[model samples]
Target: MMFKSQRFFKSLQLLIVASLLILPLLISEEGLNSIISTKAVFKYSIFCFIFLSIHFLHRYLLFPKLYARRKTILYFTSLLFILAALIFTRPFDRLMFELRPKPNQVDAPRREPPHSTENRPPMGNERRSGPKIDVLSVFLFLIIITIEVIIETNKQLSLTTQRAISAEAQKTEAELSFLKAQVNPHFLFNTLNNIYTLAIIKDENTAPSIMKLSNIMRYITDEAGNEFVSLRNEVDCIEDFIALHKLRLGKKTTLNYEVKGFLDAEKKIAPLILMAFVENVFKYGISNHSSNKLIIKLAIEDNILNLLCQNSIYPDKKDTERSGIGLTNTKKRLDYIYPNKHILEINDDDKLFTVKLTIHL
Candidate 1:
């Protein structure tokens, strides 16, 4: 379809050019009769054919194969050769006129009164053969070349931009996949460790904890690889994660997890984006010998989602090396997925670690 449309437009352009070239002859004293005459028609046709031939040759062949490929000398040489050819061929119509039979003219020469060279009008043949190179024709040829060059340059630029954009998109996708892969294993390892501790202690909650892990795993397996998941599903997964942690919580630990706003079914979020913070709360903020308080709050209003997670810090329980990886990956994911659409602030003081995140849906 596109090729057909392009061909149609090209044909229309050629027709318009041919008409413009022939317009002068059509508007002369003899008007349409002069253009329809055999000599006039033949001369105009030859000119149009040569002009169009050069136009296409330069546009498709010379530009693409030589000039565009940086063959500067050869390309310019080709242009000069074409110009020379046009200059040499300028008398082709006169040659044809002299060769053709003219039955109306007698073979014997007739004497005519000679006029002063300064005042006498020039002969028609003299006017036709004035210059080997027509300045206007040269100018028109330059215009054609300029227009083609501009069009081809623009086309090349557009094609280059599209390729660059495609490459960037693929890179972003690969990075996101790598980050998600890192997150899944880290989360599973921690969850399994908690379940392992429960099993070692022979706690009755072990089986139920395993069941909760099963649900969390199901969510991960089904939705973790997706770019976005429903807010409801994400909330359910977070709740399940918290429940899994609650099974092994120390008596001295107090966790306050709250969701203050209604969750919209249509709203969606990056899967597991909030889990890293929640996981850290259980990992480093709880203690069996000392009282520990952990608070997590999530609110949604006016198409914006906000999260606040605050936990009591334990100096002796800190694991610096492994602790930052999850948060680092999550931060990168947030930057990739939300960019300026989200704001994340983390504050770590002597006794408390606080995280605040705001996202525009």
Candidate 2:
């Protein structure tokens, strides 16, 4: 229904413009007499038909096919061809309507003016007294056609911009969906592993780890689906994850987790964005005989969220493949969500691996 209404209005607008153009000619003194005479009416109808046909041809066909395509030679050649055809055929068309009534048979010979040859201008310089060609109407047709071309060009540009925006939106949605899908399974696996180790050792903290896991699962299922979540909520989830991992740590492990500066409730971040780095520490930093050190710090200063994670790696205990959506998906998510608003840097050495991330709130 909406489409039909729009098309109807467009047709009505075209009709109104056509009426405004041709009605003035019909209401003129010469035009009123032409309408009363059968021969003159036929000639006037032909002129109007040619005028409208040329106007539309230039606007719809010639401009788009030649001018818009940057075929400069072809465009000007076609324009000249059409104009020359119209100019040359006009005389033949006028001759067909030159049927004035003849005078009676008793006429005398005509005489020239008494002015001398010197007084009169030379034949080459003398201007013809007959009606000059009417080019104003042709110029008006060209102007209207050019205006139509400009309007169409602007409309196309606007449509292109809208399509670009829509495409970017769709890409962002797809990326977020993939990240969420990975987040759920990757998080659940690591949490379950920590609980499994506790159950094997028959530790008293096994039940507490399960409880923390339940709370973490609830938060992930609820908030990880969102595009952004409060910074406080993210910090709470990260703390819960750290507590669960601590159950499996031995006395040789030095795990220092700290959060400094104000964590404004209104400040939001992509869900589970900071958890990946912390998870990697528990996955690869622990060793059976070696002392391990892990440091995680998060600070908010002047609307900037700064994160630093550093962990010592035992040469014998380092896993060749640090599985689960560790850094790859994290980096991809950062690019999609934060883009130019975040900075990420990683420095790895023989003994330790460090990650620093800064985000603009």
Candidate 3:
């Protein structure tokens, strides 16, 4: 019902504009006085729209070779029709224009002066007729039409470009949000695993673990839901994530993590953007066991975030094709969301497994 109402209003607006356009060619000052008396500025508006719409329709639809011949033929036909209309309608329009509310005694030159056969050679001379045109009026009419067509076409083109740009912006925004949502679950699964591990251990630090989990969940729910969020919020979420995972890993496993320069308050980044590399650290870094095994470095400098995660990989045990959905989804999301903004490289061999993600926000 709402849609139909809107459509009806749109149709009504079109009708009003069209009516105003042709109104100048229709009613006269006397006739207008009979209908309604006011100083309403009824300018030539419809003729302008008709004139431009025809030109554009010609350029796009008719100018092509397939239709050019047909259009040329149709155009000649239309010119004939307009010529006939001018011949046929001019007298009527002039008659209406000349008509007064009160009666007049005499007519001017337009009142049809006597066909003076008596003045010169009466019966011997032939009647001479002028061309079927008013040169000055026709020239003015054409000039007005051309000027109006150009102005209206420019206005319409500007409106069309603005609408196209607005639509593209909306589509980009929707796709980016969907890309962000796709990575949220991977983070959730990891946090849930932490809670499960803490439960099995029955650790005293479980309360703090729950708090970290809450912060992570809240960050995902609240911050990711928005169109944009502060860079600080994203960094804090990453901090809480590493802290929670560190609790699970314990002091026995070697861990080295670094933080670089500050993230500006004005800077903003997509949510769940860096989850893939961090997730790989936990999934693959678990059984490294060597005294100098685990090493993960993340540093942000000059608006660039460079991270390197290195863990040990046993040749026989670990899958060289460590292809999984979480990592694949991360790669795809990075492409769609960041494009030229980031580079990710993963290198793995017998002794060391390394993944590096670099992004310039």
What is the number of residue pairs that collide in model 2? 0
Question: Of 1 and 3, which scores higher on lDDT?
Answer: 1
Residue range 163-266, candidate 2, lDDT tens digits = 66865886576556555454445456766887787789997888988988887878877887788999999998889888977766789899999999988899
Local distance difference test values of all predictions, in order: 0.73, 0.71, 0.59
Worst 10 contiguous positions by lDDT, candidate 3: 37-46
Residue-wise C-alpha lDDT for candidate 1, range 1-361, written one tens digit per residue: 4345446545655664565455445445555555555666777677677777877898679988998899989999998898787666763444334333333455674445685355343555565434556555665566666766766666566667776786578657655655555444545676789889878999888898888788777887788779899998889888988887676677788888999788999999988888878877876788787998999999999789999999987778766555322786678778778979999999988689999999997
What ordering of candidates by TM-score runs from best to worst? Answer: 2, 1, 3
Q: Give the residue spans of candidate 2 off by over 4 A.
A: 1-207, 314-319
For candidate 3, list the clashing residue pairs, or say none.
Answer: 21-46
Ranked by lDDT from best down, the candidates are 1, 2, 3
Ranked by TM-score, the better of candidates 1 and 3 is: 1
Over 232-303, each residue of candidate 3 has an lDDT whose tens digit, in order, gives 887777778788777657455777777777878877776666655665666567653444457777787878
Winner on TM-score between 1 and 2 is 2
Kindly report which residue stretches of model 3 are placed more than 4 angstroms away from their true locations once superposed. 1-204, 225-228, 250-252, 288-292, 315-317, 320-325
